[model samples]
Target: MSDDQDQEQDQDRPAAPGPGELSPEMKRSNVRFALTLPLFFMIMFPLCYITALHLPVPHDLPVAVVGAGAAAFIASAAPALAGKFTLVPVDTPQQATDMIFQQTVKAAYVTAPPGQSAHMLVAGADGRVMTQLVPTVFAPFAAQAGNTVQTVDVAPLAPGDGNGIGLMFFMLIVCIVGFMTANILGNAAYFLPMRTRVAISAGVAVLTPIVLFLFMGAWLQILQGTVGQIVAVIALGAVTSFTVGLATTALVAFLGKWALFPGMLVFVFLNIPSSNSAYPAEIVPPFFGWLSEWHLGAGFVDAVRAVLYLDGAGLGGHLLVIGLWFLAAVLLVGAAAWRKRAAAAGEADAGDEDGEGDEAGPAGAAASGAGPERVLLGRVHDHHGTPLPGAVVTLVDHRGTQTGRTSTTDEGGFRIDDLPTGAYTLIEAAPGHEPAARATVVDHHGGGGHGGRVGDIRLVAHEEEHRHRAAVATDGTVPPSAGSYGGS
Candidate 1:
């Protein structure tokens, strides 16, 4: 047979495996991924729950003290109750009542003159645990003055939500639904553009909260608030859902299938424990208390409590936290979309330079095995020579346009294949480090299968760079230039 005929026959045969056939590496990766969930749940559930929930010790719980001699009583009691309670002395019972309604104090202790029982004003809306804990802690203190404590629920929970924790559970439900919807969209409808995905997420956020509100409020009667307050709570829920959905979707787009780990880590592990839902932040460990200050779940729960029970006191601060998270999520999704577009544009521009057009595609002649593959290989490392995995390497052409990009693997290795032979500037960047750049040339006659190795590229930490510059400035000497490189 003629050589041309033989070549044509060989080309007719499939060069790659069938669509249903999974590579051995892919199979192993899938198995490992499936096994990771139970392990993650086991570790995170205990770590987050136990550390935050188990043996909660209230630290500096604010309790307003009212009536005459309140200041003197607190002064005497302050030493023994050093870390447990912060006694805020108020002139009258009205001030203490106002503080409880405003959520400035968890509860208030009103001392009677002598024989009459002292009243303990507690907000059931602060959760059943706080209501019970306040009286228990203060009863002995009241007894020392020859007076018994009488507990009063100044701001009680809704009749249907006897425990007062239903709002927090509601917030958790909304958040889970929000993020899960993003997961579905990421996996099932990934072809949708970023704008479309965001719109769909927004729609889900708005609708899901309304549906949940109907079930948790209208039907169940668990929620208690005016029409405006109810609307505000619903808005907070929508914001929570929208922010979480967008953030999770962005993570999926950026991290691919492995996004679940970080997604759960942020939304579930850190968020739920720090939410101050089951227990207030003052009662929990300090780590969770810190998280509660800014976490999404905490913001949602706090906002709901303010709207429903606290007469909107401190609502703005809680909303601000949620707003910041929303802004961050929007920025993340925008950045991911921009990166995707830039990558596609780079590939298209590279294809145009190769004169490949649509038919030849991004792979160009290399796809048809018509020419040797022009590839670049490199490893990224820290100044200490430790491999910097997940570092991004970008190749820019002479025209200052990005042509290729790839991330370093577990071993800090990266490869950009099927490139056109040309001069390029390779930039390696990792978080917390200053980006390193070097010039290199890829040629048809390059080493090993027409590809070139850029070797090890090291990045210095930003602090090190700053310190070096400062030291040079202090010495009255010019800082050394960032190193230069020539074509390989």
Candidate 2:
């Protein structure tokens, strides 16, 4: 009896998965997915949250910009012009008392006229980034104007600050902090209405950069630039992170996967290498520099240059690029989500309308064992009842497993088929349309094939969707970089 029973039990068991049996095509796909996945998220995720305004520039500090030279020096040293800056445009010595008064420049500067001997003004500020850039900005202008400009700082650097590397430290810190904070937000999500979620997101989005920049610069004494400037740069960092994080969410949803590795790949590879803050793109390989020109880091680099060097801004274009990227990501992701929601809603409205017209008991609907049956039929169309094409419908069951699928009407309605006759859920999706979902039953009484039911799934494309925003508004090619722009 025992042997016979064991043989019978063994025959009833399911076959096991094959060992090392992955096909060549499957292996290649897995390998490609492993490689391409990182590249996709790296570029797309961080792209959503970036913004130009959030860039940080250290604010609040004792800075003295004293110059005995032309006003061009002051202009070149605009970023480093510390509190109560004193600018002596003409080549005359400025009194210390006067500098203490109107705050004319952080310190005072008296420029020597053209053909005059070189003379340097002495002033000190806590930041070294500013120190390096002030000289660079003024040097070119002075040389062009036929004057010699010399700078001397009387104030000493802070204990935490490096000789000339503090700004780089701040930039690195800002990026690191922003990236982590963004990750935290990406994790804490819930099922709130779309509009409410957007509002909440905007608030969080606004605060992330402001707080991070202020906390880091103030705590670390990251830069000696004015408090306002530091705050600006920090803001830039935060905006960049938020946009990136949101885009990351969209991608994860589309891939129907966890957000971790894809997000990490984005933060690590493309974001870090192309930062261009660690090393100027100019000195790096062609690829590094080229990448720098496009990434948020490029704006960050230019921003740091503005806050530290005080001369090489290019803020308008750099910030514009970052802002535009975020704008585009928001629209793209928002549109996709909207479409999914609208389709689901369409099915729900059909059910409600049908209920009022012809009463049907739940018991009767349930009696057919809810077998692959369609107890309901509906149609989706424009307000004028014209059937639309190319709409995608996703069918979900009680357990949330998708069971049915179809496209839009040739005339203007929809039919959902091949399901148990019981209650089920439907989700519809279309680009540029708000998403809609609902629960319903199928026509399964006639068996699997015959059970298919037609229900119109109607959706209207958003008015805004009629025209997409321009990624490149200008018809012209970008003026060639640095050299071609006519200034080095």
Candidate 3:
């Protein structure tokens, strides 16, 4: 048979198995990823929640004793309440009230004037559990004096909010929605510029808080702060959303598909247990109490509580911590973008050097009496048809052995030369994008200087690819070139 006829026959034959063919290595990788996710959730959920919340005992919970001889009274009662209450002596009831408003003390006990029952002042805005616990701890002293205690709630929760934790639940919803929004943008909008993604996140941050504030504060009437105080809480919510979203985006940029593990670890696992929303920090375990001092959620909860109930006590410190988080996340995202741009520039430069010899066509080599080089080349593009620089192109033969690997140039072009004629799979992959594969025949006898050119290979962003796969699964329709090959 003539060489032309043989080449045509080779081209006509099927180059690889049908779509959805997975190599052994790919199967193992999929299984490992699947198992790792459930295990991660199992360990993190129980470890953080159960450990922090199992048994809550107050550690040096601050309380004030008011009126004359209060110091002597506390000193006499110290042994009974050792390690549980940190009692301070105040000269009068007014001073104790001032201390409570400033959040210097959680609650206060006032000694009765000659015959009246003693007063126990508590802030119901500080979780109800803490409010209830305070009076119980001071009940013995009141009983010894042959007087009962009259509990007064200085800062009470809104009548609509029975549990006083509505804001905490609202903050959690805002945070989780912000986090998921950023994650979705990272995967689905991978082709957008970094600044655009950041802007989108900022928009979400602003909008989420305002909408939730209207629902939880205006519509539900669960929040009982003044207009300015409510605005302050809304501002804090915006900061929380922006900070968490940007932090999650940075993680996604650096870790790709594995970003969720650390993102959830920081924002959900650690943040929730230490937030002091359900229990006061002093009542929880020491580790979580320490975390409450600086953790992101803790800062939000503290600042909101201060604004709504404590007359903005300790507000500056909590805002400072949250601001620091926003700053750190901004820096991390900038670094990720810079790193990606630098790596792409380096790969483009390398691709240029590798392409130098390819300018001489295969015809030139054939004329020189040397055998034609078996080179395979192509350009990669995103779903929008823009060049995708730094995309990885890997070649694997029918035996599942990787034959060559190269990254795309600034123009999204790549070349792999000196291959033995065979049927092979070309795999294209890039960060935050779904990998794609197609089969092609590389026959030296095809009469061209290059063995083959697979045309432009387009890759879809992860979200789009996922949707496509879901559609395919539902209809039992096979997508073209959905096969995976082994890698070295």
Candidate 4:
């Protein structure tokens, strides 16, 4: 390096920073960012209303009615069902479903030629849910009439779809969400200050999946689906994690760590329960029913349920919601990163101005301005020097804009950034390990405060066997054979 360049660099700074080291001005400019908080309600309300709330049952939905008695006799109950569901009544035995290919009726019920037991002919072309509806609705009528409704499938489901396609589709999306969250959080922990963002990100990261997973399983027993549903939840965990990670990073890029709360409320509290996976939202409480609008879980679940149950009548709206979220998040995150670069350049320019002024000699300038606040950021690792992945990091100030936040780190380390000079409760995320949030006092007021350095902030990932045991004891069982983070 030339002496001239070296002198110019030293002249610009009160102190020289080592390679990869961050300066106060640099932190101030790059650390803070802002962007649009999606108008979730506005985006999803219309679709939720049209398909979920509105849509009258499609009419003459080719329902094959197979039973005994005459035209009015077998159909004594048809008028009642038709009042609600548009049912196509196939009159005779042989001619009942001759036009099945004509798409006239979806199912056919043929009386067993006078003395023969009644038989059913169902079209295999329809969705699993739509196909099942025929049998489910017809059984009660046969029971009331003292006649058995014997069903014969003219068509059956494809083997691959035995578990139902919609269920698998939802599982795939959940997997996408999980990986997306992991990568997003990992990026923030790397780009921002590692120490603070780690625990907070990890905290929100892990809990988000756990919360969504447990709800879909415990609150709604949709987890008990056929062979297909058995491990479907595991995939959902992946989806939930990745999708949340994307939102988290996008939010953090713009809003910083506080983005975790809104992310969860957007994906979890709003999406999962109201998804109407177990029952139609009409059956659930009205307030809780709107989950389909604001929550991704609910939105995907609705889309999957439609593909599986609604015969594809209502998928358009929910698909639109997911598409918008993913696209918008990608753009916002890109913009936020761009802004950081711009801000960093601005700070660098400000430093150059200072050097020029100093060389020109001190003018009789008496004006005073506060210098940038120093932010403390560091990585948290175990004593073993391994990345304490999935750790939570938190940051708060006196005003409490950060009143509630808990985030987790990705497979790397932790970071906490954008903090003004203040005392902070720096917490780490260890599921069962309850480590008190260590405290730190930043000193950006360099000339008047302690020293040039911001402050000392260090944390170690705690190993708590007792807590793990307690968690198992309280739950009366251990986690699956999967690793601690709920995996195989």
Candidate 5:
């Protein structure tokens, strides 16, 4: 209670953070993780879910029709249905039933006898949404014929699998785990070699499904599938999801943090809603329905459902979708790794040049007094990283001042000498290649230590570069902003 006690407490208290004390890295981390990620999830999660589920109406849904008049009735009423049903005429009800079992059609419409109710053979195993939708779609036709429509679930959902959505939820969980696991591995173990990361991904892919199968299948009994069946579906789903994450992470490695946009757009936005897990593809929009045919989540869900209830008739197609995604991801990650290695080698070469210059006696060079020149050195490479010769290189200082202009020699090397020390923008332009801009910093401690290295400038081929290049043909007017690939 006394002044002495207060003084002792003040001494024990922690110091406040000083002004500008937060490192740039810390600020960026908070902005990306604490602020951005939470906001993104909060906004996108609800938006994606609500938008995907809201007002789902059938569009171009294929159905098999039996009997002489059924196909004609569907064709006549198709306009009123907003092109919702694509009716395929079958010779007999058995043919329609076979098509439904093969998943060639979502449902089968059997024409009723005169003065009798019409029967619609639906597959509850396709999805609760689809099963429910069939009746709604056919009710009008049945009404026009003065007959009530009866929906008979030809392929039924498993026990405890309420409305057949259990499998969808299971697929969603597997996808989330698979991608999130890959992301965690990519970030936490980023310092490790790519091959090691890939191996780790494979191991995680194997282990995660095993755990999921035990929990969701054996322990929970929510998924109605045999042990082997569950294991296969889980494995395929995990591997596919992990590959998605790996590809996103590799993009970050190659294109830097900004690549997260496309990655999330593809995997989360475009992939999930279109996955046909939340709603049947037939009920959702045409775009989503199309995506459901090949998207990883949809493929997994289809495979799981087929194996569990449809006797695995069309499982291979879904499995093929998963495999293709995995292959594309592997290729993307491989390309990123190659670029990383090339960039590192370029840096090493630049560092070696600086070392050699340093060894050439700074005192003697200082005596030469060549107008305090800040030398800019770098090399140009094509998309595959082959050195590009005859490339034009230009430099502009931070103050919008243009300076050193040169061209690459046979080895894709260029140098600009005799410039005041400051920040600069380096631009590489070559015919048939996209121009690239790199920011450089030139700091000279008086003496021949006036070395400013721009390392490597990779110019993607015109056809391959996704970004639009600025006009580098002008008087060293650097237009494209310096981003993740800043050279120096």
Candidate 6:
């Protein structure tokens, strides 16, 4: 049979192996992927949530007691309370008030002169969960002096936000949005260029806080902070969420679909429970307490509490933690992209050596049964250096008449055999990737088929339009002006 007849016969048949012809390695991989989903979702996910919210008790909470006489009485009568509280005794009520604003104390009790009622001051903005715990633990001590105990709220919750638990809800919302953004961006990485993807994700992350701040401060009147402080805290949160999303997407792109489990385990399972919103780290298990010191979720809550209620005290450490998270995520994603490029370069080098040995001389090529007709050969790759299989390649002559057509193989390679010796426009098109056209001349006498080889054709993606629309929805314009706040 002629070469044309043989080529036609091969094109009519299946190119890849059917399911029954699967290799043992492929079968094991499929089974492992199936099992991983159930293990992470069904077992680990619920277990983490239940363990964190079930039971919580104050372990080493901080509170201030005014007056030396009251401090001595508490040391003698409530020794347990002294151990649970990092107690700070001050001479006057003003000093105790300073401690609450500094976040050195969660609540404070002022001792009455003698035979009078005691006064308790608590910061309700420290989240309702812990705010309630502080009074519940100290109510007994307040009753020792007199029957009447005056409970005063130093920092109260927003009028609209009935309880301070709304802080926890906002934290959860930030995390969910972050992970969802990462999932969408990660899928886009397969088609879009790396720099474009990074710019889109990071830009959106930086802008998200502005809109959230406007809603929380200007519109909702929930956050009791100056415009600058509110913007700072919310920006930190949005950047932290952006980093988490970027890191998760990078892991999945580099390591495959199974890599999602590790991201979920760290960012969701561990982060949410240890955030110190639902359960204070001081009152929870040591494992979660350790995570609270560094996790992004905890950082957002801590910074928000410090800015809104604690007079901006102890916010530096929380902001540092969030900055570190963003820096580390950027490094990880960059490393993955670098590694992928290096691997593709290595493979291309090996292919070049083989192609060089095959192309000798046209006279010698004819002796070895190579025809006079020149052939075109090339490979298609995405922006990330990933092979794109089943991509269509069409050849058109100078007049735009269709000359030949072929599809990329399972290895992302294609060769159109027995082509006429002439100039043609080679168009490489693939799903998700941008279609590219290049002009090339094919001649059998040119370098004995060595110079005719098209090394690698890279394709861009059509993801920018989708990303732009989404960004507009989240951050279309600047937020409204914030209102002034008064301290109690």
Mark the regions of model 3 whose C-alpha exceeds 4 Å error after superposition. Answer: 1-27, 113-115, 356-488
**Cα lDDT listed for each candidate:** 0.70, 0.44, 0.70, 0.43, 0.63, 0.62
TM-score for predicted model 2 compared with the true structure: 0.41
Q: lDDT per residue, candidate 6, 229-333, as tens digits?
A: 777777776777688777876775565555667877887788777887647777777788889989888988888877776777788988898888888888888
User: Model 6 scores what on Cα lDDT?
Assistant: 0.62
Name the runs in model 1 displaced over 4 angstroms. 1-15, 353-488
Worst 10 residues of 4 by lDDT: 469-478
Q: Distance (Å) between predicted and true CA of 128, model 6?
A: 1.2
Query: Considering TM-score, which of the candidate structures 1 and 2 is the better prediction for this target?
Result: 1
Model 1 C-alpha lDDT per residue in residues 373-486, reported as the tens digit of each score: 255555566645566789998999889999999898766667687676666777777888777665555532211111244445566666542211100000011111123231
RMSD of each: 17.0, 19.6, 13.1, 19.3, 17.2, 16.3
Residue 399 lDDT in candidate 6: 92
lDDT of 4 by residue, 1-488 (tens): 55456446435634422223343544453344222224444445543333443432433344545444546444576677664444444556555555543334556755444334555566443445445666667666655655566765554443444533334334434544553454454333332332244345445545554555455545654333344443433433443444555556655555444454455455544453355443334333455555546556665665544443334445677667666765665576566556545544443343334222221111101111112234333333342334444656566554545633434344323333444555454444545344434333443221222211111112233442221110100011111011022211
**Highest TM-score among the candidates is held by which one?**
3
Cα deviation in Å at residue 203, candidate 4?
19
After superposition, candidate 6 runs with Cα above 4 Å error:
1-35, 210-220, 356-488
The C-alpha TM-scores of every prediction are 0.70, 0.41, 0.71, 0.37, 0.65, 0.67
- Relative to the true structure, candidate 6 reaches a TM of 0.67
lDDT of 4 at 264: 48
Candidate 2 wrongly placed segments (more than 4 Å): 1-160, 163-204, 256-262, 307-312, 342-488
